[model samples]
Target: MVAVFSEDHVSLRASMKGLFAQHSSESEVRRLMATDEGYDPVLWRQLAAGQELQGLVVPEEFGGSGYTWVELGVVLEEMGRALFCGPYFSTVVLAATCLVESADESAQKEYLPRVASGEAIGSVAFVEASGRWDEAGVTMEAKKVAAGYELTGQKFYVLDGHVADFFVVAARTSGEISLFIVDRESAGVSAHLEETLDQTRKLATVTFHDAPARLLGAENSGWSILGRVLKLAGIALAAEQVGGAQASLDMAVDYAKTRIQFGQPIGAFQAIKHMLADVMLEVESARSAMQVGLAAASGHEGLDLDEISPLVQAYCSDVFELASHQNIQVHGGMGFTWEMAPHLYFKRAKSMALFLGNSDSHREQVAKALGV
Candidate 1:
């Protein structure tokens, strides 16, 4: 069965939109981006206490809202529209999903409540220096120790790693890929912030030198768990890209309608009209692709997420890149300035395009899945 978009979802979207408009304004995003923590703690708490946003997909038994990915996609879309500078994507989408999918009840009971309440922040350390997001990319070694295990290796491009309280780290255990939970404050664990194209989202390089860790799921089964998490993360990210594309279109259209040129609004020009129209088409089509991902993620029958996830990711990434670029073109010189919002969206588009994997890589995955 296909997932239905209900009035509740509409109401939730409206609520989140208002919340972000107030708390995650352009100025607020700029301010938070420059901060070390990279997000407003007060707003983060409000999301958990008032909106229960952090627990949207967490099961009810673990103090979460127990909602499905469809609702979570709505929240993420609004966040993308506002360019929210927070660790929600890392803590909820990446870390929480890993734990939930691992099927380790002990791990869930121990850590999920804290995540659901926003009392603790978490992220995943998956990619290494090679910058590959696949099973072959995991080279961090986890050796058995008297206490449990000890990890020694480094991870790069870990989203929000500097601010995370703990990490769901992927490492090689006995020559097999496995998952481990390591506290940020653990001995021999260090994180350093890294410069990135998108300032709104922070990335970090984390090194684990004999850091004590606890096994998350069954040893040697991490790649399977991570595969499911990546699929869900791809769907969620597609929703975010759709929102950003729409925002870019809105920004361009608004500027065109007001910015006067040649004795009339620039929107009156055939060139500007055609450009905006093309952006609109792309945005609308990207929304459709995002919906397909959401449906597949929400357990809609007869949908193969492995196929849909890559397709959605590739299409949305391309559409968002085009929309943001066209938004800059519409504004002429101002769009290129650091003061304008177009550059912000453009940077985010470029960064997100490479986050999980690039468009070409996703397309290759789709082709491989098709056995072509």
Candidate 2:
């Protein structure tokens, strides 16, 4: 049996890495970046065909191995490092987490197994025009109709909205927030892809014009569910950011050791040494924070991360930001060019750091958690 750690993961990661490395050639990365869909279908099928990533978070009963979140983190880090262009994050982590956060047994039974089997794609449609990730930011209203509920409002910056078959939308009903499941093909539902700086990850403007929606939980009890969802998403995103940061750090280290300047490898120079050491520190620190966050989310019991969650996220974001710029700095002019993949990783880092919450926002949360 294939393991999920060091050797097994590395071996599995190698194959996927080769696939991405082949496609990340200057021309291919640039072309895919410019395209509206932002990913190649052949590569997508390859991910599904191997099911190389199927067992991480999914429970065994749902046709998955029920492995630890850290295993998923390993895959995420490698994928982010390669600037792997795909829906794995938005669909698997973001949407799948939302499904697990839902307390409704009927909903989970109806959806998660399909996700585990790779038969359905879902997205967390929570953010609005304000880009707020909380209940107060949800202004979309759901009114009860004989058919179910009529949803009327908009969700902006929804990740993978253009392709998600089902959307876990946040809406207000009778002065409270709730999770609603809406079919993308249903009448009154529409979405258009949004232009984003990181083309590998797609964003979309979603509109719900009297769209009929099914409630996933108690009516008007959305805030409680969303709070839990946010915590889970925070942990997942923190993991992804950790993954992205590790990539930059690795690239910087390898480049520093090989690139020659002043008749010697730059790795011998004090300045380059300092930068690589700093990158190492950031990667290790971020990894520790992410591990703790994931452990807490994995139900270690009585571990209150209300305060710790944002700190890890903010810390990892800082790590990504610093490591990204440094990756470019270390490469000098070559890094600035589109032909090198350094800029691609840097671009992706910048975009993901801002999502969920930026370093600044997480700092604010850290303070809030302290009751200051």
Best by lDDT: 1
lDDT of 2 by residue, 117-219 (tens): 6666788788888887766788888899999898988898888898888898999888888889998999999999988878878999889999989998888
- Candidate 1: pairs in clash: none
The TM-score between candidate 1 and the true structure equals: 0.98
Q: What lDDT score belongs to each candidate, Candidate 1 first?
A: 0.93, 0.77
- TM-scores, each model vs. reference: 0.98, 0.90
**Model 1: lowest-lDDT 10 consecutive positions:** 1-10
For 57-144, candidate 1 gives per-residue lDDT tens digits of 9999998989988999999999999999999999999999999999999999988999999898999999998999878888888999
**TM-score: which candidate is best?**
1
- lDDT, residue 170, model 1: 96
Query: Over all chains combined, what TM-score does candidate 2 have?
Result: 0.90
**CA deviation > 4 Å runs, candidate 2:** 1-31, 52-55
